[model samples]
Every structure is written in C-alpha cells, then in structure tokens.
Target: MALDPTDVGKIAELARLEISEPELTSYVHSLTQILDLVGQMNAVDTAGISPMAHPSDSPLRLRQDIVTEQDRRQSFQEIAPATESGLYLVPKVIE
Candidate 1:
C-alpha cells in the first residue's frame, strides 16, 4: 500500500494539480499511510456481522408535508430584469 513519487505524479496529473517536490514528498507519505490504514481495515473479519445503514437503532421522526407559504411569483417577477411567461431569463453563457 506504499505510494511512490511516480504514483503521486500520476495522481496529481489526473487531478489537474501542481505539486512541488517538497509537497509531493509530504503527499506521498500521507497517501501511503491512508492506503495502509484502509488495507488494515479491509483485513478485519466481519463474517457474522450484518451491514447497517446507520450505527444507531433509533427510529427517525418525520413531519407532515403541507404548504405553509403563499405563492408570490407575480410580485417577484415584476421586479426582475427579464421575465417571459412567468419565467426568469438570463444571458446565454455557452454556445
């Protein structure tokens, strides 16, 4: 699970990042430790344990869904710079 300079360079290139030689050394060490920790975690035996969505067993409480506010679209649209058919318009950004 050790990461070398070449592995760090490839990761930096793929992520569009610029890493100095000093920073690259630090990154390599940190990444290697993280990978080693993950490797250790993966080596643990969990054959009898079932997968869970949450760590706790508490039930979640949900509120009733209902409209609690009045629509003010016309008032807001009247103050907008551009509006057409109750929809706001903006300048085209892409060709």
Candidate 2:
C-alpha cells in the first residue's frame, strides 16, 4: 500500500504539522515498506495456536488478596492545606 504525497500533506494539515518535501518522501517510503511487511505477514498460517499472554521462563504466581496497610488518617490529614470533619476542604466554585 503506497501512500501518496498529497495524502501525507492532508494528514499533516489535519495534525497541524508542516512536513517538508524530503520528510514527506521519506515517510511515504517508510509507510509503504511497513505495509508491504504487514502484507507478507498476512500470508502466514497460524490456525490453531493458543495465544500466550505472558512469555516467562519461571512459573507465574499471583499474590493473595489481602489489605496489608495501617490506618494513617492523622498523618494524611496533617499534610492537607485545609481540612473539615476529617475530610480535605476545597473552595466552592459553583456560581
């Protein structure tokens, strides 16, 4: 799939970019090569292969669902600029 210079110009206009003639030519060539490579990859046959999520050497292990934290309300509130009734206070912005 060969992308045209005019198409690249239109894309640049939409993105608010000023692409020069040399850069546009380079981009078109690179994009064409990438499309060609993808087209080549489309010819591969992978019919019944299971998709592996993670590729790791060792056995995967998940941590148990447990809350390992201490309640630090006073410590947290101490850093706040303004606080009211154990909650951080913010300026009312509604008209």
lDDT for each of the candidates?
0.93, 0.86
In terms of TM-score, which candidate is strongest? 1
What does candidate 2's lDDT look like per residue over 21-43, in tens digits?
A: 99999988887788888889768
Q: Record all residue pairs in model 2 with backbone atoms less than 3 Å apart, i.e. clashing.
A: none
Residue-wise C-alpha lDDT for candidate 1, range 1-93, written one tens digit per residue:
899999999999999999999999999999999998889877789889887889887789887898887999999999999999999999988
**TM-scores for all predictions:** 0.46, 0.39
What's the CA RMSD for each of the models?
7.0, 8.7
Regions more than 4 Å wrong, model 1: 45-95
Question: What is candidate 1's CA lDDT for residue 37?
Answer: 83
